[model samples]
Target: MLYIGIDLGTSAVKLLLMDETGRIHNVVSREYPLFFPHPGWSEQNPEDWFEQTLAGLEELVSGADRDKVAGISFGGQMHGLVILDENDAVIRPAILWNDGRTVKETDYLNQEIGRDRLSEYTANIAFAGFTAPKLLWVRDNEPENFARIRRIMLPKDYLCYRLSGTFATDLSDASGMLLLDVKNRRWSKEMLEICGVTEDQLPQLFESYEKVGTLKPELAKRLGLPEAVVIAAGAGDNAAAAVGTGTVGDGRCNISLGTSGTIFISSRQFRVDSNNALHSFDHADGTYHLMGCMLSAASCNKWWMDDILATKDYAGEQADITKLGENHVFFLPYLMGERSPWNDPMARATFTGITMDTTRADLTQAVLEGVCFATRDMYEIARSLGVHVDRTKICGGGAKSPLWRRMIANILNIKVDVPACEEGPGMGGAMLAMVADGVYATVEDAANAIVKVRETEEPDPELVAKYEERYRQFRTLYPALKPVFQEIAK
Candidate 1:
């Protein structure tokens, strides 16, 4: 049997076709536009997502054995607010996860309502990117649209509804919405009341590997697939990426350095930190995981190389960065504000300690090191919670760079394992589909069978020691600049 994985990303929908044995047969990607109506606000049309996904699926399965396709699943960008009217038509453009227009709503939740109550209700506090804040924003700013809302859906759930005619979401994705009692894996009643929404407005919840419904006959037929094709409940992008990298079971970790950077740690038990800095969310594997997300990572490098330096030669620029841990210049990787430990959307990127003697290599190296240093901040938080992580699997675009991988391993003082297949969330989505199809008994079984390690980068004591000192200084810069960032934003 064959399985299909759809990764509904911010810029594009990536589709993957895989066989029962985990061999990828075909892959297709379709790009869509991201709209910004106001400064710091991000939105996308749900119809664009469905249309692109439909077209991508048609292309993905074109040369494959259509009759053998058994299931389809998804991994998508989380925390986007999609609403539908009574007629099931989209009410408005989706407010995306990267959107930062919910400052007022977020402040109201974190201050007026209080973070303690929120953490009690949902096991997480309000962030500008969270769905609860977005809902509150819509209610306050667009009351007319809010009045028309019949259903609330996340980005991928919209696609799931279009494909399977089922309004459903997986635990991992719902956990990020600030509407789930994550510790218990259910919608939080208090949050529903707080957001002025009812449980009926939300989608039915399922574990990521569970089957939601069969594909709609029209969609299946259009794609030349069987009507019986199972539609598995999918996961949030990071959790899906973790599954693809085989970072399941207790003590497993996966670090993703895409546009956003995330440190994902899987656990059999549910745990939340004292400060709620790390997200306590349900895992795609029917367990639980803690994640720390940084708003910018690889984008920092992109900004420096393309926007600042006016060149697309990322490797050419990085080639001169031979001095690993001794650069005097330091950078703060907060290009799009920040999340995780800081949670400050006002924070701005800075290049500090640059001397007249600083070379281009020194500045370039700082950007990479800054990202690694921020990653270590999350690792320290996990360690403080008594979750010992000796190693982590690395994935995403930045993981392809050997220098960045080495920096991550040394700076975090952990063994960094690289996966043979780095398809990230798309691959994980297919694996979930295989589980739903009964080709694998469990998510863990599917992960263990499919994920293969290509190589490992072990931390060196000398390099680790140097990075340790550098990280100490890097951690202090954020606090020193906090008030400055706030003032500038005002």
Candidate 2:
């Protein structure tokens, strides 16, 4: 049987077709415009996502045997607020996960509502990107729209609704809404009260691999698909990416260096970091995981290579970066501000300790090293909670760079495994669909059968030692500059 996985990303909808044995048949991508109406606001038309995704799906399944295609699922950008009115029409362009207009609402939730109480209720505190804050922002600023909201959902759930005609979301995707009791995998009553909504306002929840409903007959017929094709409740992007990398069982870890970077550590037991440095959420595999995310990751490299250097050949720029840990210059990868350990929106990127001896190679090396160090900062906090990670599966565009892969391996001093298929969340979504169709017994069984590492990057002791010293200094700069960043923003 064949299954389809759709990655509903910030900039594009990526669709993949995979056989039951996990071999990819074809992949299709459709780009959509991302809107920035205000300086710090991000929005996108929900209709655009559905249109592009459907277009991509028609292209994805065109050449395949129609009878072989069994199921479809999604892995999507998390925490985007998608509201529908009584008529089930999209009320507005979705307020995206990266949008920062909710800073005031975030402050109210984290301060006036109290972080400890919020944490107790939902296993997380407020961030400007979380959906609950977006709801509060709507309630406070656009009262008419808020009053018109008859349904609320995450980005991909909106697509699932359109495809299957079911208002549904998976636990992993719902966990990011700041309204779920993540530990219990249910909606929190306290959070519902805080958001001024009831259970009726939320979508029905399902496990990531469970079949939500069959595709709507008319919609399926239009796409040349069987009306009986099942739609599985897919996961949040990070969780799906983790599953794609086989980071499902205990102690498994994966680092994604996409537009946003996340260090995901999967476990059987649920545990929250005392400092709240990492997000504790339910995994798609019916377990728990801790994730630390940074708003900017590979985007920093893209900025330097594309906008700053005016070059498209990323490999050509990195070809000369021979020196790894010895560079005197250090860069703070906070171009999009920061999340996870720091949680500071005012933090700005900085190039420190550059001397006359600094070369273009040195600066380039710093950018890669800076991201690795930032990832390690979260790794350190997970260690504090007794989460020991000896190795990690690596994915994303950054993982394509051999030098960056080695840098992450050495800087974190752990083995970095490159999977045979590096499609990330898109592949994972397909796997979830396969599970929903009974191609596999469970997510873990599907992972064990499909996921494979072709090679591994091992850290050099000498390089690790040098990078350890550099990381020590890198950790200090953020704290020392915290006060300066606040003053400048003021």
Candidate 3:
């Protein structure tokens, strides 16, 4: 039998076709537009996701044995607010996970409502991108739309509903909504009441590998799939990527350098740090994981190269950056504001310590190095929590850069393992589908069999020492500029 993995990303819907053996038969990607109405605001149309996904799924399974396609699942961007009216019509453009328009609402949740209360209810303090804060923003700003909202869903859960005719979301995805009582694997009553929402407004919760329902009959037929094709509730992108890299069990780590960067540490037990710097969310494997997410990662490099430098040659720009951690220039990668340890929406990207001698290469290197430095900031938090990580599995667009991987290795002072096949969330979604179809007994069993490490990038003691000093300097910049950032916002 065959399975399909649908990764509904911020920019595209990536569809993958796989067999029970985890062999990828075919893959297709369809791009969509991302909207920015305000400086830090991000949104997308729910209809766009469904339309492209429909096209991508058709192309993905085109040459495969259609009758043998047994299951379909998803891995998607988390925390996006996708509300629907009573007739199931989309209320507005989806407020995305990267959106920072909820700063006012986030402040109300964390400062006014109290971070301790939020942590007690949701195991996380409110970030500008979280759904609960977005809910409050809508209620405060768009009262009419808020009144019309009959259902609330995440970006991927909307796909789950459209495809399977089931209003369901996997626990891993729901954990980011800031509504789920993550440790208990249920919605928090306190959060629901605070957001002025009911339990009925949310989707039914399921484990990542659980079969929610069969695909909608007409839609299944349209995609050349059988009516019996099981639809499994999938995971959030980072958690799903962890599953794809086989980073499960206790104290396993994976670093993702996509549009947003994240250091995900999977654990068997539930634990939250004193400051709540890292998010304590349910994992795709039905356990729990601590994740630190940065709003900008690869996007910083993209912005520098495409928008600032006005060039398409990203590699050419990086070729001259051989100085490593010895550079005097530094960059703060807070273009869309920051998350994880900082959680400061007022933060903005900056290039500090540039002199007359600084070339384009120096600035370029700073952008890449800055992202690595920010990642290390999150790593330091996990270290403080006694989560010792000697090595990490790496994935995403930025991980393709040999220079960036070396930087991450030395900065984090850990061996970086590159997976044999790094399809990330898409692969994990298919693996979850395999489990839901009974192709595997469990997600771990599926991962152990399917995921393999191709290569390891080991850290150099000399480079690590140099980066240690660089990171120490990087840490101070955030604190010094934080007040300035707040003032700038005002």
Candidate 4:
């Protein structure tokens, strides 16, 4: 038997085919356009997502044994708002997770309604990117469209509906919507009232590994598969990536350094920080996890290297950065504002302490160190909550860099384990499918059986000490510049 994993990403839909034994047989990707109608707004057509995914699925199983496919699951971009009309047609372009157009709505929730109440209701504070705020924005700015909404879906849930003909979402993905009572694993009634939505407007909820429904007959026929193909309710990208790294069970940790950086910690018990610096969400493994998300991670490096430096030679540029934690320059990794801890959309990236004698290598090293220090900020928050993390599995593009991995290990003073398979969320999605197919009894069982670590980067005490002093300084820059960022935005 085989399983399929669909990773519905921001730029593309990635499909993976794997057998019951966890061996990947084929992978396919299809790119789609991301639209920006305003400076801070991001949108994508839901139709484009379904079409590309359909096309990609056809290509994914073109030369494979389609009849043996047992189940399909997903790991997708979370918190994007996708509304449908009575006819089940997309009402408008989806407002994406990175979209920052909900400032007014976010303020209304966090300040006017109060963060304490919001956190109590949802176990998370409002961010501009959450689906609830986006709904409020739509209600206030596009009342006509809001009036026509019959269903509210997340990005991947829209695909799930198209494929399985079921309107459903998994706990991990729904948790980020600021609509789930994560502590209770149900929709928050207060949030529904606050957003002017009802229970009927939301999709049915399921655990990440639970089967939602079988594939639609038409879709099954088009893809040359059986109509009995199970559709598993998958998880948010971060949680799925955690599963892919085998970061399940209590005290497990995974760090992803993709376009956005996230520090994900899994726990058997549900816990929310007093300040709500980290998001308390349901895990894909039927447990719970805390996540701290940074808006820009490797994208900051891409901006500095590709946009500013005009070089695609990331390795070539880093080759000269031999000096580890002794740089005089400091960088704030706030290229796209920031989240987790600060939640400031006005924050801007900056390089401080650059002297005329500062070399290019010094600035480049600062960029990498800045991201590591920012990660440590989240790690510190986790420690403050008594979630002791001695080590973390590392994934994403930046994790591929030995220098960045070393920096993370030393700065956070933990062992950074590199996984043998770095496919991230897509691989995790397939694992969930295996669980749904009964090939594995539990998510943890599948993870334990399949996930493997290739190597570990142990922290150096000397380097850790140097970074400790540097991080002290790095932490001060953001707070000091808060007013400045606010003024510039105004």
Candidate 5:
């Protein structure tokens, strides 16, 4: 039998088809527009995502034996605010995870509501990206629209509800919403009250591999699928990517370098950082994990290459960026503000230490190293907690770049393993569906059988020494600029 994995991303919906044995048969992607009506605001029409995802699914399974498709699952961009009216209509364009419009709301939660209480309720403090803050933004600014809300959901749950006739979300995805009692894997009543939301407004929670429902009969028929096809509640993008890379069990780590960068470490235990820098969330594999997310990763390079350099040749541009750690140029990857260690929405991207002799290659290398350094910030935090990671699985858009992969390996001073099937969340989505269909006993069992390392990038001692010093310097720059960032915001 076959399974379908749909990865609902920020820019596009990527669909994948695979048999029970994990061989990918076909893949399709459909792009949609991302809108920015205000400087710090990011939004996307839910209708646009729906249309593109449906079209992509049709194209994904076009040539395959659609009748054999047993299940469908999702891995999606997390923490987007998608609200529905009583009539089940999308109330507004979704406020995205990278949207920084919730700075005020986040402050209200962190300062007024108090981070200690918020963390006690949800196992996380306030961040501009979380759903709770976005809800406050809507309530304060668009009271009429907020009053009309009947249901609240993450980006992929909207798709799940539309396609499967079920309003549900999984633990891993819900963990980022700042609405879930993540340690307990349930809705936090205190958080709900604080956000002026009720339990009825939220979707039912499921384990990531659990079956939500079967596909809607009409959707299944139109798409040449059986009505009995299962719909499994999938995970947040990072968690799904972690599962895809086999970063399961205790102490395993994975780094995702997509539009957002993340360092994910799976832990059997539940523990939040003292500084609340890392996110403590339930994992898809029936355990707990910690994640540190950066708002911009590969997108930084994309902005530099496309907007600044005016070129489509990303590979050619990186080909000349050979001097890894000797460069005086430094870049702070905060284009969409920042998350993880620094929850500063006022932070702006900057190029520091650029001299008159700094060449284009130095600038490009700085962008790559900057992202790696930011990831290392998370790694160091995890180390401070005694997690002790010596190797990590790498995935996402930046993981495709050999230069970036090498830089991450050395910068973090850990071996980076590239998965044979580096499809990330999509592959993991399908694997979760397989578990839902009883093809596997557990998520870990499925992962152990399917995920394979294609190659490993090892760190060099000299390069590690060079980056150790550079990172020490890189760390100080953020602290110095933070006061400036706050001043500029004012």
Candidate 6:
């Protein structure tokens, strides 16, 4: 049988098809516009997602044995607020995960309501990117639209509803909403009340591999799919990427360096750090995982290459960065503020310790090292929680850079394995569909059976020692600049 995984991303919807044996049959991507009406504000028409997804699906299965298709699922951008009216029409443009318009709402949640209380209720604190804060933003800024809201949906759940005619979300995605009692695997009533929304507005939650519903007959037929195809509840992008990389089971780790960077550690047991530096969320594998996210990762390199150096040849630019861990210049990767340990939306990027001796290679090396150090900050927090990670799988766009991969392995002092196929969330989404269709017994089993490692990058002790010292200095810069960042934001 064949399964389809839809990755509803910020910029586009990528669709993948796979056989029961995990061979990718076909892949298709459809782009959609991301609107920025104001600086720091991101929005998208939810209907655009559905339209493009449908169009992508048509292309994804064009020549496949349509009758053999067994299931479809999704992995999507998390924390976007998608509202629907009583008639099931979209109420307004979706407030995206990257949207920064929720500063006031986030401040209210973290300050007025208290971070301790929020962590107790939802196992998370508010950030400008989280859905709960977006909900509050809508309620306060556009009360008329809030009054018309009949259902609240995450980005992918909106697509799931359009596909299956079922309003549902998975635990992995819901965990990020700040409306979920993550530790309990349920919705938090206190958070619901605080958001001024009811439980009825929320979608029914399911496990990532659980079957939500069969695809709608007419819609399935429209896409040349069988009506009996099972639709599984998929997960948040990082969780789905973890599943794809086979980072399931206890102590497994996956580091993603995309537009954002994340250090994800999977565990059989649920655990939260006392400091709450990492996000404690349910995993796509039906257990738990802790994730530390950095807003800027590969984008830092992009900004340097595009905006600063006026070049598009990233490889050519990185080619000169031969010296591994001895650059005197240091960079702080906070281009889009930051999340995870710092949780400071006011934080700004900085290039410190630059001397006249600093070459272009030294500055480029600093940018890469900065991201690795930020990831290490999360790694240290996870270790403090007694989560031992000896190695990790690496994926995403930045993982394509061998230099960055080596930097990560040395900085974190872990063996970094690269997957044969780095499709990430889209691949994981198809794997979940396979599980829902009984192609595999469990998520772990499916991952073990299908996910293949291509190569491993080992850290040299000398390099690791150098990076350790550099990381110590890198960690201090954030605190030193915190006051400055706050002042500038004001």
Per-residue lDDT for 1-490 in model 4, tens only? 9888998988899999988677889999999999999988889999999999999999999998889999999999999999999999899999999999888999999999999999999999999889999999999999999999999999999989999999999999999999999999999999999999999999999999999999999899989999999999999999999998999999899999998999999999999999999999999999999999998899889999999899999999999998798899999999878888799888889999999999988989999988988999999999999899999999988999999999999999999999998888898999999999899999999999989899999999999999899999999999999999999898
lDDT of 3 by residue, 154-258 (tens): 999999999988999999999999999999999999999999999999999999999999989899778878999999999999988898899988999999999
Runs in model 6 with CA error above 4 Å?
none
Could you give candidate 6's per-residue lDDT for residues 1-490 as a string of tens digits?
A: 9989999988889999998788999999999999999978889999999999999899888998999999998899988999999999999999988778888899999999999999999888888889999999888889999999999999999999999999999999999999999999999999999999999999999999999999998998788788999999999999999999999999999999988899999999989877778999999999999999888898899999899999999999899998888888899999878888888878889999988888998988899999999999999999998888999999988999999999999999999999998998999999999999998999999999999999999999999998888888887898999999989898
Over the stretch 1-490, how does candidate 5's per-residue lDDT look in tens digits? Answer: 9998889999999999998777999999999999999999899999998899899988988898888999999999999999999999999999999999988899989999999998899889999999999999999999999999999999999999999989999999999999999999999999999889999999999999999999998998889889999999999998888888898899999999999999999999998997899999999998999999999999999999999999999999999987778989889999999998999999999999988898999999999999999999999999999899999999998999999999999999999999999999999999999999999999999999999889999999999999999999999988999999999888
Candidate 2 residues 79-123, lDDT tens each? Answer: 999999999999989999888788788889989999899899989
- All candidates' lDDT scores? 0.93, 0.92, 0.93, 0.94, 0.93, 0.92
Off by over 4 Å in 2: none
The per-candidate count of clashes, in order, stands at 0, 0, 0, 0, 0, 0
Residue lDDT tens for model 1, 1-490: 8888999988899999988788999999999999999888889999999999988988888898899999999999999999999999999999999888888999999999999999999989999898999999999999999999999999999999999999999999999999999989999999999999999999999999999999998887788889999999999999999999999999899999988899999999999887989999999999999999998998899889989999988899899998788988999998878888888888899999988899998999999999999999999999999999999999988999999999999999999999998999999999999999898999999998999999999999999999888888898899999999999998
Q: In model 5, which regions exceed 4 Å deviation? A: none
- Candidate 5 lDDT for residue 177: 97
**Of candidates 6 and 3, the better by lDDT:** 3
Worst 10 residues of 6 by lDDT: 268-277
Query: What local lDDT score does residue 149 receive in model 6, on the 0 to 100 scale?
Result: 96
Compute the lDDT of residue 74 as modeled in candidate 3.
Answer: 88
TM-score of 6: 0.98
Model 3 lDDT on a 0 to 1 scale: 0.93
Clashing pairs in 2: none
* C-alpha root-mean-square deviation, each candidate: 0.9, 0.9, 0.9, 0.9, 0.8, 1.1
Q: Tell me how far the alpha carbon of residue 113 in candidate 4 is from the true structure, in angstroms, after superposition.
A: 1.4
